[model samples]
Target: MIREPDGSIKIYVRDNRHPQVIERQLRNLDVRADVTFLPPGKDCREPRGTYLPDNPALLTSEPPAEGKDDYWRLHPEQIKPGQTFVYTMWYEEHGDNRMFTARYRVATGPVAPCEVVPGGPVMKEGPEGGIGD
Candidate 1:
């Protein structure tokens, strides 16, 4: 974790394991976070808690550059009290390629445990599809 001059925190996560440890570390930094690392092809049910609306200004990410690591920039000053940040990550494999996915959510109340379930299917629309179809 790197503290920026703008008072924001940048966190680079290279591993999806040990979510509990990550949560503890964030708590030590006065950042309430609930972290969960799901298994491949599994996901948590929606409405895990009373989530806040999406705020890109408060939280944003940048892909890795030539010599930099991928990181999420979090402006804690924008976060209100009693709010908890939720982070979920997983990995997907397609043939010989592997992809990492992560999601961020802010909740005002207690967060629910990650009840693992199968992920939904990926939908693809073609040019033949109609607006009412």
Candidate 2:
């Protein structure tokens, strides 16, 4: 986790383990986030909370090119009161390769616990390497 001079927060999750610790860290940063790491074939049900319209300016995957850290840059100020960020991550292994996947969601008001269920088929093409890829 890195806090920028402009008040934006950048997070890079190199290890998906210990999600509860991650949630606690984000909370300490004054960011309301619910982090969940699903098992190999599991996923969270949709509509876990009130959905917020997609806004790249508020939360984006693209990182600044010059930085060595490829973090998810977030403008927390853009997140209104009563809003919480939800992150779900999981990975699949094929032969010697592991494919990591992450999904981000925003919820307003009360956010419900993630309802575990079997996830859909893996994408034909996922990020080839780590997040920096």
Residue 7 Cα positional deviation in candidate 1, in Å, after optimal superposition: 1.8
lDDT of 1 by residue, 25-92 (tens): 67777889888877655778887999999887878777777887557777877667899989888754
**Each prediction's whole-model lDDT (CA):** 0.73, 0.74
Expressed as tens digits, the lDDT of each residue in 1-133 for candidate 2 is 7788999877774545678887887788888988888866677887788878876687777654684644677688877778898888775555555566677777898888889989833533346633221
lDDT of 1: 0.73
Lowest summed lDDT across 10 adjacent residues in model 2 is found at 124-133
lDDT of 2: 0.74
Note the residue pairs that clash in candidate 1: none
TM-score of each: 0.76, 0.75
